[model samples]
Target chain A: MSLQASRNISRFWEWGRKIICVGRNYADHAKELKNAIPKEPVLFLKPPTAYVREGSPILVPLYTTNLHHEVELGVVIGKGGTAIPQSAAMEHVAGYALCLDMTARDIQDECKSKGLPWTMAKAFNTSCPISEFIPKERIPDPGKVNLWLKVNDQLRQSGCTSQMIFSVPYLISYISDFITLEEGDLILTGTPKGVSAVQQHDELQAGIEDIVTMRFTVDRQDH
Target chain B: MSLQASRNISRFWEWGRKIICVGRNYADHAKELKNAIPKEPVLFLKPPTAYVREGSPILVPLYTTNLHHEVELGVVIGKGGTAIPQSAAMEHVAGYALCLDMTARDIQDECKSKGLPWTMAKAFNTSCPISEFIPKERIPDPGKVNLWLKVNDQLRQSGCTSQMIFSVPYLISYISDFITLEEGDLILTGTPKGVSAVQQHDELQAGIEDIVTMRFTVDRQDH
Candidate 1:
């Protein structure tokens, strides 16, 4: 009813908005997992409680033995809309962020075998750790940017936006047709290859081209 | 940080918080679907975009032909906490609302078999419709209340909360253990048996004993 709130895009997480994720958007990543490259985008979600900034650590859910890190580019919505056209989708972008879509691989494997939802594997607390927002002006061409990830100082994931199966605008338009993207809502574009397990005290570093980089420590949650 | 923004519980939907969901909490329903009774609660999520009220209609996603209606009891969290104990879990409740977890059964079945998330099937626009909020005092025993649903004036689901395999407090405690429950967050505590498909012009009426009732019409989404 009212116009979108005048919240600062830099602090959108504090607004408690939706975190819609796209899975398997990279062909290499799909191959690495021995999965079929999807014809359409694979989608999932992480609740707001999943968000953790630099000050807080990425605590592994107590139930999982394998906690994997997925480096992704997160698009933050500046405008809200339903059935947004691809041509006009970029107009809705406020900016972007470097993010990790942490996954509990063991739990995810069990859930998959049992034909269950991936919530336990994907939506736990500290499942989503992100960098500070990067204004749209910082990246003149989102489609050509580079994204990289490192664990313990060794590069684990390295890819470019050009390798994405679906373009950012295409994803925005497709998702908005049904899910309704709103201001402050986040859409995590799927990860690149080189996803692997992380142990306690491990450090993860990720970046978006030469624009921004973020670091986080991994810790185990006590039962 | 700002004392929960002094948000009115009755208008929690406007706040755009998480809609965490429990699946197969009702044994009879799991039996009907040929799913095993889960040892622990099965969880999923619906984004805030899925919410719709009485005045609006539930539009079946163009991707699904078997849209099913699942009547559920929704718990509105008033306080925020993590790893909440079972005994003190109820103390965090702000109130309750009768809700519908509308699912695109066909798409959900496909997702389940492929080991994918249920976003398209479960989190589309208008997938969640809820009744007016009932203060905590109104429902003295959420575990013993009567919940029922009718389609086109024919009773399709009639089950008491007494049939739920997992009680309200246990669900709250279990969920808050990994996914922190926060102010204004709503949780759909799963549906009972008798889940079935609905079509265009189908009128859905559901209630929580005599405490609250809500209604909505269904129609196919035009592509």
Candidate 2:
């Protein structure tokens, strides 16, 4: 086999592609944050540098005191296109991963009130912690998976993908209508309700029910 | 020379690296928009998909009609680092480019009032139109250069880098403190005052003093 063909797709994160994120895609999440239901998908971005694998700890940025953990399902794109139709959105999927959208809540609140970008609150190093990639054949229905997270062995968040206000294909089409979805680009299908503060040295365990689970530790980042 | 060495720095955009942008970095710009002179640098990100080269027309997104043009200087990173000190920031520079931070003013206003992300307002396909890269040797003092933009032969924005609230090295240091500066990544120092809307087929001409000049036409995007 050629070098590329023999390689596993699990290492796709190393490609350094876009990490397009959906915000407030779940009605429960929107209600928890007191944000109104959106008429359309709200989007944001995190650079490739945000990705932290299983071994490394999610470092809470020194600038933020109240760090929050937002667990969500990550869809890895296999193909790339612009203005892609909703019907063909799934063909762009390569696989999936469980991801934590670590946020600095305090900073985000200030930015929100002041009408500022969430870069400091959301785009810091080790902000994204991801699980092992699950192939397409593993889960027949992505919309029905149960994503749960625990902090220090205490259940903190648990939600069904069916609770998403926008479906996977719809988000793909909506996002692609504006931002071009490229190969290896991972779309974070928004977080569920129950996003709360996570402290230093906190142990975080998250999983997509019946298929895969991953564990990570949180530590303070230093200068 | 190896395959890398032989390649010119101008091709850095093709590497698909992060495009970190500074906002309200110019005092005049802050005032023009009625925004406070920020105590520190305001930052944001534009994905690589936003880049549009010369000869390609900048497409106006169907979602907005009031597309404004803000011309700024682009810094291309040569070295990668985190928590980079301002003193050593200059050494990380590889070259520079003249770029337009095309924005949808109407959509941005709505996003701001709602305290939402600027992704839809700022990050769209062809949102960033850039000129060819200039090597580091060509511009020894980037802070002293002049940036001017003319729309359809009328001088709309005329300003100097000296008016920048945060200097180039300062921005590099600040941004790298949060977002790691990778080689091939870009940093768009904020634009000066005099930002306004442009209609379809309007010509945009921008340059850095007598160093480099680029022109592009605007066109409405179709579904």
Highest DockQ among the candidates is held by which one? Answer: 1
lDDT per residue, candidate 2, B44-70, as tens digits?
889999999999999999999899999
DockQ of each: 0.63, 0.53
User: For model 2, what is the error of residue B56's alpha carbon versus the real structure, in angstroms, after optimal superposition?
Assistant: 0.7
| Steric clash pairs (candidate 1) | none
Tens-place lDDT per residue, model 1, B1-223, is 2435546789889884899889998999999998899999999999988989989999988888899999999999999999999999999999999999999999988999999888899999999999998899999999989899999999999898888888999999999999999899999998999999999999999998889998999988876
lDDT for each candidate structure: 0.91, 0.90
How many pairs of residues in model 1 come into backbone collision? Answer: 0
- Top model by lDDT, which number? 1
Strongest candidate by TM-score: 1
Off by more than 4 A, model 1: A1-6, B1-3
Candidate 2 docks with a DockQ of 0.53
